[model samples]
Target: MTGALAVAEKVPEPLSKAKTNIVFATIVLGMLLAALDQTIVSTALPTIVADLGEAGRMAWVVTAYLLAEAVATALAGKLGDLFGRKLIFQLSALIFIVGSMIAGLANGMTLLIIARGIQGFGAGGLMVTAMALIADTIPLRQRGKYQGALGAVFGVTTVIGPTLGGLFTDHASWRWCFYVNVPVAVIMIAMAARTIPRMRAVVKPIIDYAGIGLVAAGVSCLILGLEWGGQEYPWGSPMIIGLFAAAVVLLATFVAVELQAREPMLPMGLFRSRVFTVCSILSFIVGFAMLGSMTYLPAYLQYVNGVSATVSGVRTLPLVVGLFVTSIISGQVVGQTGRYKYFPIVGTLVMALGLYLMSTMGRTTSVWLESLYMLVLGLGLGLTMQVLTIVVQNTVPYAQLGTATSGVAFFRTVGSAFGTAIFGTLYTDQIGPNLTDALMQVRVVSPEVAANPQSLRALPTEVSAPIIDAYADSIDHVFLWVVPVALAGFVVAWFLKEVPLRDSARAGATDVGEGFSMPEPSDRLVYLERAVSDTMRKARAEGPVAPRILADAGSDLSRGEAWALGQVYLHTRIRGAATLDAIAEVHKLPDEVIEPIYDRVIGRGFLTEDAGGLRLTDTGRAEVDRIRASWQRWLGARLDDWDCSDPADRALLDQALANIAAKILDEQAREQEVAHV
Candidate 1:
């Protein structure tokens, strides 16, 4: 994980730009469907209710879709890590088209809900696979712009969803809401099948079944509790309480199970990263506020404000427009400058301000004013939302990219669910009594309307206005509550320490601040110092650390030559393979120079050479063995640098070098093996 494999200088010549674009377009279209489906159903609910006669089950339509999607997101990311993104993506597209067809042709509400769940599953795969593939294709430096384009796609889809839903429901049929996916999915599937290059699967990790079970059980229970508690059951109902308790136990068991597993679904080491932990927290908070608020906003516009579905669709444009502009700008800035900490800092602050501004809205407040508030909030969200993903991915090594990114996505979904439930409760508690009071004043309430609070919206204007006003008041309070959550996100954004974005191909090759070359070793000075020290140690009353005071200093070379040559004699002596006195004579030096080399070599008993010169003694051979052993240890410590297949062999080579060094000195060879493998 520490070292990166070097990338080829360019992609293979056989790959064409047209093929690459086709692949890219497929991913984009898939992502568009996922983002659009999240909001599209809200605009078509009325028509769906009239056809199916299940207005009471309306919330489940969206809840079931989201719940299925959330599970698929994490699962798809894991599958891509084990298999290949191209394969999973193609399969997901096929599943999506099939689900869309089923939903479009369904007769009953139950069947349609099940079909939506299937559609949600496909959406999840589409999102995770699309994002992960982008990372694989693009370099980190250029990825920001591509990620920005994804954000733009999401923004456009969010605005388009409601409008498209209204057009389908008003002019044709509510079934088109489901059918619209067919053609787009078919195109995307064909594009993907034609363009994405085939790849073999990686060696799969040992599957941790117990950990998977606990995670699935835990998240499912928790999400169900949030989705059902306020609407289908009371807050303190036994079923709700039991589900919450089950979630806690299952989640705790998941952690324990993963810790014990040899190959964990979620690696515990990921938590060791401070930035990853903080990013997960921020993602959760953002999801909680964004998804939860967006879920009920359409209801407020239609049921509370007497607006048609088309008008509500048009009115939400400001939010999407704000997101589009800010997302693109932030992406460009982050890519060019390589400094992104400030965007989130500024964004979270503005988001909190916008939430605070939204809390001030009343039933009679100006429509433009509300739009302005949403626009501000959307812009702030756009800047911060994707930036955290960038920071988290940047903090980890490339092999774990899909896992880390999906982990953030999973936490965000949890936050969104919790946010929706809490706000749902707050709205119900505040609106119910105010609605009753408003109806009493109008004096036209029926038993059914009183019993089913949802029916109050269909009453005459005189009877419904006051009740709708109460909804506006309560929803504003929900926004007021969200301000604090947004503020907490701002605090979380503060701790992200910006590390330099390194190019993956060059990650472990060299220090970025310096050029690629390593300095050559200077062994001449090492031998010179060793010789001088040995001479002094051997001399009982040596004058100084000078070379001549000791005997054996010029055993092969003459004193005069040793004296004149000084330290330069060490390199010359070794190269010539000469005796101590002969080397000294050749350089025309005194014992002072060559004496050091002779004394040191003799003392260490490692001066190996031929009969033509002084050779290593038995003790010198042992010393060489010790040096080789030390070198082997040094190389062993850096085994992580070796690739999977090479580590054991590299360690063996290091040990072999050590043995060779030792054997040469032991045999007192005239020629020594220095540092060869």
Candidate 2:
């Protein structure tokens, strides 16, 4: 045991600052590949349709990818936990590269759609695993900065996707859009192989294939119904009706299965927390508005404003700028203040206002006015986007951290799919009749030209004016319908309870290593209380007890001195001086290192040096009591609603809580001993 402790102490910590930055950069690259792919093909769709001669089926390209991505995201995190994150991450990147290559070489619309589905599947895995890896690697206190920067990447890629697609379609081939992911994915795969740590579930792995199948089928059916209704099939048609019915039945089955599964993919228990439920709903709404708006805005600009595809992409910059700036600022503020509830509330309200403004836009609305509306919408999404994930991470137990994080992401992707589908339905329903009527009055445009929006700019002014007005009116109505969605999100944000963020270094130590261990809830509570105390002290500018004070007190204690003091105080009260010597000897540390820490405590009046060796003064005893109280309060907050009606279970919890407090003191003593050496 002594030799093992000595060797463990000698091992350096796994993640240094430079390594963290490198892994973070690799994560961001993987995330960008996924995020950018979501929108990059939008500008190339027309070219693809023209070449493939399938004008009516163009929407399927986007829909297929989204559907597949949503399913992949829903399962990726659990697979990572079961298998191992590094292996899954690498596999996901490789899949993405293969899918991208297949897409680039696709010659038919059907083949392209299949390729896109493959790409989406790979992209989905990349996104969820990348996010889970971040939680695994980075400490929570500093995660916001990296997460915020990732949000910026999403914004930049979203804004530029269309422009880049347009440039490639015009100057090069439309295939480049898919080809673009290959090199970036390759680079990500390389970095991940070298930098990402191996982490796997400590518990025995169980495959929840039934739960996975039910949920995937349920979500797939739901999206398919939404996509085909009012476009390919009537709302009352049997196909749509059957799809919706299957969705409900399958989803219910999934819930039932989760209750019994040894390791369910998405644990239903997490939804018991009000914070998790509210943030999830908010995430859904944000995805709805953000993606729905992005889908239609460019079409509105090109058809109504008579702009080229590239020009339309460039004009949407204000929205991206607003989103990028606010996301970073919000993340930074939350990191510093540890207050997050306000941002989402204000964000949703602003989003509703922006959608309302967009609803009011008409055929004659100036470009500047439209840009201003987009900026407002972007700002609202920015504030809401990154914060919800951060909140989910903060509240969930480390055991469910990956599952919870991916669950929130899965909702957002599902929301985006539904939003785009419904928005398309509304636009097509409104535009079909209006365009037909306008063409009858002015025969300048052929039915072919009217069917293909890409050719709308080629029509003369007299013929295109009515068509433009029809498009503007249809898009305005789509925006009007979404106002309610954003408003619902705003109301839900009000119910989000603000929980204090946990310190990553203390609470997340287990998260970083190879073997997973589920610490008892009471053990976690003890660590949580100590972390909270450290945060409070730092916030009050009273942290990192001065080295000079240690020197003045004739002790060579390090920053870990408080922990050592607490240990000495605990040992003297319980098992006597023999326990202290045992601890030092077992850890293979000299007695002098342990002795000075107590000497410092004695000098500070928290302890007294006497013939008995050492004893806690009144102040020291009071401090220990305070630590106990803090742990009790933290545990109470977490377990308030937990069922404890059985006396045996309740007693077990009580004993565990008391044991954890002592365990914390012992662990700190060991760490301090190493630091002093």
Candidate 3:
């Protein structure tokens, strides 16, 4: 174990604080652009269709992007591992810029749809790689705060996207929606090139092209079937039936391929854990409810209530407000209690109740009443969204962290695609017949005026009443149909087993360095108390402990201090010399900064100056052994808790734990080594 730790210590030092921040900022910018674009084009869709004269194919504008994004997300993470994250991220940004430019200048609907698909492909790569970069650059202890901030970014973009789209569509050309992405993409690309680090996977990467192709084909077929059934073709028609059958066969084949592949894109082994399975399902439901509802609600507000695009966007603020408030509160509460299962259960129930309430809305339903319903739904979504991802991260082995994280996201995206398609089908199925009946009753409305929702506003109140009612009823039915889906999610939430969240990065401490040598449990206890104190302070400010506070409880040792001690122990045991200058050089800290820490350790009698260099005392040797034992126990307990039965996995966990313990020590050592300088 000591020999391995010594060899591992030879790796290059981490980036400086300034460089890390720059890289993180670049990642967030890319993520924001990708996330923002997901919904930004929605409000402009009606105007886009009107200008292009393709009302019947308008849904394709969104569907093409979604399908391409789903495929891109599933494959991008592996690509990042095989090549490098910085290169993949840069390529993604460049593709997005090109796609945005093409979409902005597109002369017809077909060209626009193709452009959106291209944009979606790029966006998918950006989203996945942005997340992986954080895991790469940030320390495990600080990850929760940054991850929380990223989640906030998603929420902000989701709320503001429609309003931004509406503003551009109403005041300028709808082309501005795509055009707006160009500048953001250009800036992100510049930052990434300058700051993003080149990180390669430790193990040789094997591309799972067969698995990728099968899954992509399967998802595309399924989405097409859902999108076209009952609208473009009868649900029972051979075309729809064949698509459905093909989806099933393709998906089944994908599962078979993944089971045999060396490095499967999806990694079917993760499903062995109950937590991963449950979280994936819950994530799917959340996406289904969220996008499905978001897609149609604006139409309801505009067509049924006779509002402009801007007003419709403004009216959805109640839901956004509800989402923001609950998300913060839930995070804070979970940080304090470390209890997560309840939030999803309560969230799904509230979501179902909200949907049921929405189903009861009629033409006479007041705006305030509708707003209240939206608030309930938003609150439900907020509570569930943040927690589900945390649980998945908690359960998976650290080595598979990126894959697990992306897997949850992949399921959510797939859910969004299916939700939008199924909801569109339900809305179309109801609205067509309802409109026919409404026109028959209101004879004063001309067929041409009735066909266009924008013209409905000019009609007399008597002529528009039935038409408005028809729109209300169709939307109501859509909500009613979704209630069962939310309810099913509610039931599933009850089955989610709450595992204690670990604070250390999932990849384990070995990746960071080796465990620091400590004299006794009492000495370790002092550091543990400090870690707890620091965590409490951070939690009070940031919200709940969530996953951030797990193994990382506030410790007395700073990251640099830990690193210094670990380096000293490793050098004394194996490489002979343990001078302040040598430690400083290895860690990229100045000798002046590390001098004080060496003085402190010598003062404590852990080291003594000799002709060879600073050497560990007899006490120091015993302390190093204790630290190793402590880390082994800690790692063993975690593996047992996870119910890892495989002997190979247990061995990996042991090595990883040793590395993680060393890392914790290295982090503290480095902190002190650089503190004075």
Candidate 4:
């Protein structure tokens, strides 16, 4: 017990200013790299295909990287909790560097795709680990600012990626795209090694191999179905339908497996927390629209507006600017004010409006109008995303920090993948026929060619121009379709309760002093005492005293209560001693509350209280002695129970209990000596 008390006393506070800044730097820089990589490659891909002589296999480059990265992210978080954060982060950096090397060295599409997969794995670690690290080091009060900063960086990266990619692709080789990670990775690794301490390993962790397999399989099937839809097969094709069914089954099994596991990979109990559950729902919706919108914007700009990759990149800047401004300001405000419930409510509404505006784009849409819509989208995202993460981290205990943080990242990534795929399918379903009919009517496509859906992209500009416009228009319709989906996020946000945010120092002190479990209020204890007294008195009644019952009742009463009454009896008797009237005087309690308990005492034969006074018979005295003997034995047993497995806690509780017991024994011995005298 003492050791437990000591451990409770030693809970560490939040990181210092230097550490907080480093953590903030780590999160923002890492997020910038992740978000930038996703957009940067899109602008450079055309150049990549032209140089590598394989436009046919271009989509695989993006697909391969995303698949690999998504798979690695889910596990990296668990690894962080089980092993150590420092090792996982450092290893992720090294892996990214090596992947970067491979990508830079690649001479063909095949080699580059393979290398991209490796890079994805490392990128996955970076994304999840950075988020987890932020939760670990920052206090809730200030975490919003840091999380918001990351969101801002993500926005900046979105705008910069295309421009930077275009610049690199136009002036330098496409290889610089991968090479950019080198210096960033080096800096991140160095800083993290210095700032982040190595976390101790858990005593034992039960790896949910079955759950991992099920979730991986389910996600893979779903992603593959979405990826292949519209492009490869009809939406209702047997293969697609089968894959969807398999996804549902596998995910269901994963949930069931998690429940049965002793130490689950993803704790089922986390779902019970309202904050975690709601935040996860919000994340999924954000992922769906956020990734879907991003995927199509560059394509629309380059394909329909007839702009250069650099210009297309510039066009996306308004959204990023809005996001950056909102995130930074909201973060500081949230940290200072310590309230986060309102951000999500406002953010989801803004996001819905942004999506609605995005759905209205057209071939004839003005550039300024497009920028206005992007700004709305950016503003909405800035408010909700990071704030949701803060709420989750605050609701859970410290030990589950890594797991909880990683889970958020995993859901976000999976949502992004699913969203991108669904929107891709929607765009394809609407565009294919519209493009063919328009080309045919314009007399640019022959009847034979118009009938063949696959040959439309190969047609000349006269045929393809109207067709591309149709594709862009249909794609905008898909974005419109998702407006409701984005709005649905608002429903989740509305349920988010306002929880009190604790500073890291105060949070640590609470963990050591009390615990994550909420303490009962004093008023409730007073009510409980009254209830107990009422229940005990009404339940027991005084009747003809049963000898056996009296004996048992006396055994239940403590020696302290008996001694208190005995002293009162002797004191009152001495005041009227000359008569020796064969009477005992005892403290009398009012009948209204005390009569029932007093009746039980008499019925049990522990004591008889009448007009004369209360008296303890021979059996009552013997029962008291028996009760004391049994109580002593129970006290001895409690010492062992208090000696927990933790040596420090055991030593502390042991010493304290031993000291108290010795004092008790000393008092008993001194009283015996006085009686003998």
| lDDT for each residue of candidate 3 in 204-275, tens digit (9 for 90 to 100) | 456778988999899889988887888889989999999999999999999999999976777898999888
TM-score-based ranking, best first? 3, 2, 1, 4
Weakest lDDT window of 10 consecutive positions for candidate 3: 513-522
**What does candidate 4's lDDT look like per residue over 1-677, in tens digits?**
21122212221233567767876786566656665776677666655755675443554566566666766676665576556556777787888888888988899998998998788788777766666565455543344355435544555666788788767765787799999888998898888778775553333234567877788789879877876765677779999898889999998998998889864556787799888888888877776766667766766676666566667677878876776666666666665677878888898899999988888887678989989999999888777765655566566543344356556656776676677667766766776677667766687566444332234446676756676577577768877888787778887788998886644312222111111011011111111122222222222343211222224444454333343223323333333321113211122223343344445556777676556566655765566545444333433342232214556434543443333222222223223323432
lDDT of 1: 0.60
Among all windows of 10 consecutive residues in model 1, the one with the lowest summed lDDT is 513-522
Question: Per-residue alpha-carbon lDDT of model 1 for 1-677, expressed as tens digits?
Answer: 10011111111112334554566677789888887887787767655765675444555567667666776775675576457677888788878888788889989888887888888888888877776555445332233345446645666677888878767776788789889899998888888777766542334434566876788778778867765676679869999999999999999999988788875666677789998888888877777777666766765666565666666667777766776567667765665566778777788888899888888877677898989998998888777775666566567543444456567767776676567656666665666577678777777775345333346657777777776676678778888888888888899889877775422211211111111011111111111112222222233243422222113122343322223222222333334444566544543446465465556555544455566555545654343334445434432332223222445434433433343222212211111111110
Q: Work out the TM-score per prediction.
A: 0.66, 0.72, 0.80, 0.61
User: Top model by lDDT, which number?
Assistant: 3
| Deviating ranges (above 4 Å) for candidate 3 | 1-16, 267-275, 338-342, 393-405, 436-455, 497-642, 673-677
* lDDT score, candidate 3, position 455: 85
TM-score of 4: 0.61
In candidate 4, stretches whose alpha carbon ends up further than 4 angstroms from where it belongs are 1-32, 45-67, 77-87, 101-115, 128-155, 173-175, 182-207, 336-339, 397-402, 438-468, 503-677
Q: Which scores higher on TM-score, 3 or 4?
A: 3
> Any idea what lDDT model 4 has?
0.60
Per-candidate clashes, comma-separated: 24, 0, 41, 10
**Model 4 lDDT at residue 160:** 80
Tens digit of lDDT per residue, candidate 2, span 458-553? Answer: 777777888878778888999999999999998999999997765432222211110111101111222333343334334336432233333433
